[model samples]
Target: MSERVTPGHSGGLITLGTADALWAGLTNGSAVPTVSAACTCFPADVRAGYVLLGGRVVATVKAGGGQWGVPEMEVRRAAAELNVVKMDHGDLVRIGPFGGAPKQKQNDTAPLRWRQRIARELQELGDVERAAPSEGRLHHLAGIDWRVLVEETRDRTVRAWWLPRAVVRLLDAAEHAETRWLQAARTRQNSTAAAEPPSQRRQIRAAGGRQTTSPHSPTTAPRPYNGELKELLYSALSRKHGISRKVAEWMCAVCRTTPATVLDHCHEHGYVRAPVCQSCNTQERPDHLYSNDIRVASHYTRLFDTHNVDWLRHWHRCPGCRTRTTLPLPHLAAWTAYIACRSLRPTHRAPRGRKPCGVLRVSWTGSQNAPRSCLLTVTVDFCPSGEHRVLAQIPYREAAERFGTWLAETAPAVAAAAGPDRLDGLPTQPRPVIPDTNSDGQALF
Candidate 1:
């Protein structure tokens, strides 16, 4: 089982066994984003070195007696810097949305199943109450009041939730105990290298018989972070936005390897998220959100609205589902409108006693590079044995107006044909159909 980093299991230095396992896994088929010339070698000395990714050092590692270990603090620091999810088992690292299983279906029953599982786990730790779902309410040890929500997409649905700090601690403790139990049950491996004398253990250079010392020796290791300077920076940055002289003392929050120089903030809200290097600050500018891809737009909007806040503190909770989202008021209003428009699609139904046909689906498409040329395409014909038909092609900007007019006219009949609404008002836009037209707007046939 993989140990996830949470508020609970986030303490304690990583064990040698875990680090060794990680190193072996990474060096094999696993694709690490970064590497160094010295990476081919192992265990140069007891002093801590680094695990580099994308040419940047993300985490610090140490070796002793042919064993390796990572400091837990460094893991947390690196995770925040890289914007990638760290896995304690199975996979070494994940860069996308959170999930243990690949392409797992998240349906209506998923939340209930997870709730039961969590409740059972909690019962083992102590008393845990199961109460009615409440949006964004993180109850104390007296009860668990958080709600679990599913965000639907073309490929899958994602579940998001918030947990009380106390519950997280309890769960971490249980996981820790399980880890200890597993360690005790396993037999220890003998390490003859650990008993070897310093002189005998020396590694010889391929160029000559003389042994060469590693360039990344303890003397060359990065200096320790200044806690006092960090506190002062945090306090000062929270009050007003400006470049700090102390930035040289801190690593970039986006890339852990570089020294921070610029204080990055949300352009819309002007709230500081982190101190980042000049390159990251430039590349992640707020203007990138203007792309035609809703995914890209939504991602950047949320990034600016929530990234800094979430990283420095906790997630901003959604008003409806209470899923941890700190989306601003304007974006939230836009989201509500988008959801409403999406829910306008009527349910699909087949003739009585006849085989069922597919439902309506709507989507947007175009070259991401050319946002202005994006189109809103729709498909209507989904008969069992019949070929699909292209219903309409509306410009992206006119999608909502066109959809509203069309729905008002066709909704009653479509509703009557489809029977009652059963999908709980999820957006029902028809999936885009491949058009028969060519670049010149003429039919191919």
Candidate 2:
């Protein structure tokens, strides 16, 4: 089972975190928005010599491990810089939304999952070459950075490597995943190489970087995301959004790969919702209540004039038996009047059984004595043509002063659709009964 991340989890979110966040960003088509290459690469070595001269490991730890004058302190400091928790887990671990004395164990499942998973994959893919891309190392075999390769049997257990733990986990997970996973990674790599002008690919090959492919490209259709792979993606999202890992997993299954920016997970299931941003999430979370603005009392009172407008208890049927009970219309405080501009549809409760909408015609009947006499018409053409067709024309005004005032007082529903009422006493129309319409918009049951 995948370990989950929670604010109150054993070590909080940190326990579920990897050494770096950048790896997650890169794989997700983002670079660490805040972290920089100059930041210390914890648990990983930084070839300072090559970094300064080679512009790679400008800020990293050193290998042949021992101690370089308070380097541990520097690593801890870097963890603070990244806003992740840092603590002494045999060798000083880092993870979480906040940095402090780590409350995690050396056997942290988050790291273990990556180490064991990759070791197994490498054993299966047959060990490839490990190098320091920044070190200018030359070797044959499908080249991989030493940052990810396990140094020895015991080394995998130690949480120390420059590459982000997430980066390592994903790279290895590919060994067992479908070809697309690896193909996506390769495509990313090739795209990066292609952008480097001239022959960056040739340079990589010259530096002993061998082209790699998926283990086996099946001629058959690609498989659905396996549970394990889904968990990994979920964890990445959890790390990003601070939601529980399980919630993220559920979101990945229901919504999409990424979580929303604010809520992060389904409010009900406690998992990632849908296309996370506000614009997309509107469609992503159809039933999701994004705000309480419509529910608050203050906002409600301003929406209606209790004297001029009133709500009748309306009920279609009872939740049980699906039959009309003693229930009346639920209380609504002129909810339709809260409609903001730019919205084609008015704000109202989603009705059940059928949608109640019709045309509102306001025409000038010409004048007997009044010249600007406008007539207001509220027409409901239910079913248009049906056995139970409902055609109702409401009261009209012959000497109406303005279209807005007449519609607001007599046909408030029409005015509410055209625009929201500005003040009290302005009419907020209610929907009239219409014929049944199925989900497909077909008229009648």
| Highest lDDT model number | 1
User: How would you encode candidate 1's per-residue C-alpha lDDT over 1-445 as one tens digit per residue?
Assistant: 5333334555455653443333333333322221111222221122323332222232234355654455555434433333342322221111122333234343321211233344333433342234442353322210111222111122254322224222222222222222222222221111223666655553323221222233122211122233333212233465664336444345556545445555554322323445554434433322112222122122333333334333212111111111112232222223323333344333345566533233333345563123367564444335455656444455544543443333334333322322123334322331222232111111110
Candidate 2 lDDT over residue span 42-83, tens digit each: 222222111110101112222244322112222233333323
Query: Which residue runs does candidate 2 get wrong by more than 4 Å?
Result: 1-33, 37-62, 65-245, 252-255, 259-445
Measured against the true structure, the TM-scores of the candidates, in listed sequence, are 0.25, 0.18
Alpha-carbon lDDT, every model: 0.32, 0.25
Error of 1 at 90 (Å): 18
